[model samples]
Target: MSERVGAGKSGRKKVRDGIEGAKVVELRPKQGAASDKAEQDSEDRRFIHRDNGIWRRKGDNPPTFICGPVDVLAESRDEEGRNWGLLLAWDDRDGHRHEEAFPRALFAGDGNEIRSRLADGGLTLGAGTSAKAAFLEWLASLASEQRARSVTRIGWHAFGGQSAFVLPDETIGEAGERVVLQTTEREASLFGVSGTAEDWRREIGLMCAKNSRLVFAASCAFAAPLLGLLGEEGGGISFKGDSRVGKSTALRVAASVCGGTPQNGAGGYIRSWRSTSNGIESTALASCDALLPLDEMGQLDPREAGEIAYLLSNGQGKARSSRTGGARSVARFRILFLSTGELGLADLNREAGKATKAGQEVRFADLPADAGRGMGLFEYLHHEDTPEAFARYLRTATGQIYGAPLRIFLRRLADVMANEGEDELRGRLRDRIADLADDWLKDYPAASGQVRSVAARFAMVAVGGELATSYGLTGWADDTPSYMAGECFHAWLAERGTVGRREEEQAVQQLRDFIARNGEARFERWVDAVTAAEAQSEIPDAPPGERFRTQNRAGWKRWVREDDGKSAWRYLLTSEAMSEALSGLNQRSAKAVLVERGFLLPGKDGKIAAPISPPGHKKVRAYEVMAAILGSDEGDR
Candidate 1:
């Protein structure tokens, strides 16, 4: 046993071994069982405590540990109700940072899933027999005593203001500088950087000179960023025509203004119409406050075409259920999309034996691609080579110089809005559109309401393009866009015909077609005895009887008779034959309409039919239409 020692300044005893020369050392008091247990409890409390899936440090203001190379930007649930996290991660090998969605289960999972995901993302956990164990060990090493700062949570839908310009990896603003966020792991690699402002102007100027549609589409793309500021419901425009007629090229050109080319597939700016409504809703949300270009309208299911159009234009998604049976947040967007297809939306549905609604038709206006000048989608090929060659050149040139114009345009628009306020800018744009619409419809007074609406949409595109030019984003002659717009608008009007007169014209054409088809076969002759004698007899001085003779027919005829002491020629049609000829029209309603238009005379009992006696047949009821109502022979044709 050690010998008892004297008390030291610390009030603890100094102990000495039994050996005489052994140096004395201070000895601590032997702790009681309760004290030892208390110490043990304190030590146990120092370890991290996890509650409700969140890890918390033990000390005051303890730090939260998160691994690098990947950060969870948002949390969401998939269609099947599985927990998901939108992650912004870096890939050092490719020097590209991408946003990927991963299962939350993997992060909390027993190592294997996490390791597999990391490996799939091109990350290595070093040589280890147990990758799960290694990953866990590595995650543990990230823990530190430093306090963790709060991270800004980015919403999935980035709409309203410059925030809507957020890309997969960065947020772009009016300043033309990237607003570097915590989740921005790398610079934007897809859009690259904006070329010199003059480079964009030159390229766009060439497009403007080449095709009015191209200029219209490009301007729409540039003005898309201002849509949110415009404070109006969002809509889209479609470029529809035959395949390989430069429709796709125009869309690609428009896409180049924003970022990415037409061929970038899913990751690029262009999307396919082959997706489901939900899929498109997601795409639209991703493209909020930007240009969303969809390719191949023919790819969509005919049954869903109308609904899809309504959904996209309305900027809302279907509400869904979550795993817990609660309502999931519906996806929303405010964007102007550009669509390209070989067939127009209505024609596409018609081919599939599906009918399109009027709302769908108005939402996506169908303009004839042939510009009515023998040019297919282009009036003149501005490039030295053929249109195809120019398209190929554009594919490469556009990819090289993307994203800058949109950035600069947004910056400039923001500056203007900041200085003059949003209302002033929107009011100016509205006034411009109104003025353009008035000019476009000046000659189309009888245009249908739908036609006028479509014209307004075209005018909007025109106004948007012209505004971009006026803003100096596109280097073109100031009047070039307006001229192109007017030309396109007129061409559309010419091909579509007068809108308001469509129904009346259809009625008239139907009547003419019926008469032309059956007039000679269906009706019998109704010549008076005296007229018949005169027609059969040869006059001595007459030159083959050149004077007009009333030769009656069974189905229709024109007869000149004295009425109220005035000679008038009455256009007559047998009631039975008229009913068969104009079967599409309601006989009573058509007669009333004809009477109102002065086409027919109302007889006794307010009926349009009159009693007529043939030379050798029984009396018959015939419709006596006025000759003046039929107009000239040229008008009938």
Candidate 2:
């Protein structure tokens, strides 16, 4: 069905069937990093130990050991065998030890990236050219000295098919292996265990006993890793309301489940929503295979807020060219984030004069922050005097025991995977998630497909909490996670105001609202036959107080005899006015929804506009709207 196109040095040329007249580019093995690795291996084999010390190199003015005793731990190679790096360990002036993987790409320029990172991590380099040169020279010397074997993964699990979950400084599912994060944005220092798992369980685990919001938050964090497992693209669950409703507290609690609290109440474990799209790409990668806790959605620029929502769902950042005109690797991540704010996605986009699409709303599911128990966002106070005090208590407790539960959960998960095998465990977990989703949706049989999709994410959260509980991490009752997930889901549904498609609901509501607001004021009054005859005869209006003129007519309305022999009002709208009422939506879809709901009647030809003529007016094609849409009781669809 399609012709093959070919491009050569000259220009693009259409190719018929065979390879004739098409330039064939011979593939070459990857060079640069790959060639360097082979050269390094050869140099290692021909090593002579000519330097005074292992850390000493030939480049320094006086051959010197730049830092403390150094060890070349491993040779790290990407999965393709074309790229490599070195794992180095050394001590600093404070006698503290540091270990990191130094990628060869950093040495392509002045090597400042490598030197600055070493210094930042406490491996001191001398100040002058000799000291800097000594440091760089010593680093190059490590290519020949082998300590261990290593593999590379650009971001999260299984770098180069080395199947271990790589965290900032630790590895899961693999013993005696460490994950050293050496990306441009250094985040290793932000991830660590601060307290005992026991303390965390006692301080935070019990707090979620009767609180659905807190439970949902914790579940969201745990559910992040499962996103990759379930093969589901990432999305977020937001808790939004007016300011000071314990929203930040919910985020803090969720953040603690993944890593330590922000140091001194500053950025660390909890990241703000104020980051640019580029900055967030790096941040999202840093939190890859885990939860990204974003606080205060209001901080993002309103114009970029909806764009940010789309960005998070994209799973990768913008691809930009490097200095040499080569394509740079885009930052990629798989994460489920938690967002909190005073405004929902819809409100935020509306503030920018944009109408949110149904897909975007599903991507960032918004739930009301308030639990409606008069306890702010809390369902239970846990013996605290007030919701504020309770929230404050949880926030403080999270800071104390942050970062332990997640480590425990990962360890347990690793063991389970090792025993049950990933395939078997994934199957069971998948079935469990589907079952949970079914439970969430069984009550709302008519929910939209978008609603069902979001329900699966909520179900994933429930699985995480319940799995952690089964491993004795969360100390909650068996049914707690599922119960909390359902509670929060129903709350979200209530806020959405419809079980059907969100856009459909909006379409119906928009027309109803427009007619209710402007029917009498904007529509021209039409006359009955008797009134028309009287007007034609130049007689005073037969009806005492009837008026037939409209100031700025959008359409026409007339009183007609009903089947019950009572007069009822019916409105007919012009095509232009109908378009205005259905602005910002798919006009065709809106009209279909209106027809299905009996809000708009179709002509015998099945078109949305019917051919009708009003008294004293020529016939025209117009949209006829039922008056019942303006009734006082048009509740949930």
Q: Which model scores highest in TM-score? A: 2
Return the lDDT, model 2, position 478. Answer: 92
Residue 484, candidate 2: alpha-carbon lDDT: 94
TM-score of each: 0.61, 0.80
In angstroms, how far off is 626's CA in candidate 2?
A: 3.4
Global lDDT scores for all candidate models: 0.58, 0.72
Task: List candidate 2 segments past 4 Å from native.
Answer: 1-69, 129-141, 144-156, 159-162, 175-179, 265-267, 324-327, 513-580, 611-621, 630-637
Tens-place lDDT digits, model 1, residues 1-637: 1233333422322221112222211111122222444334433221232221112232333323322344333343433444433333435456555444444444565656555555566653444444344446434322211111111222222323323245544554442222222221222234434465567777655655757787777877866666666665567777778887777777777777777633462126677899888788877766777778888888998777877889987888999999999997776777778888877776777676554555676677665666544556776767545767766666666666666777666666656765787678788888887788788888767767767776766777776677678778787777777777777777666655656533344445445555555443544434455543544463222112223433445344533334443333354677766676456455666566667766667778766787877556588788776545445522221
Q: CA shift at 180, candidate 1, in angstroms?
A: 9.7
Instruction: Please write out the lDDT profile of model 2 over residues 1-637, one tens digit for every residue.
Output: 1232323412322222222322221111122233544554444311223222233333212334455445555656544553467777667668787777777766666678887787787764556676567566555555533423343332236533334567667777763444454454355555656677777778888887898999999888777877776678988999998888898888888887777634633125888889788788877777777888898888887778777887887687788999999998776778789999988888878799777888899999998889999877888988798988897788778767777777778788877777887778889998998898888789888888999888888888999999988988888999999999989988998888778898898787778777777855788766577645654465432323454456667797765544664344677899988888888889999899988887788999977898988766789999988777777432111
Positional deviation of 295 in candidate 1, in angstroms?
2.2
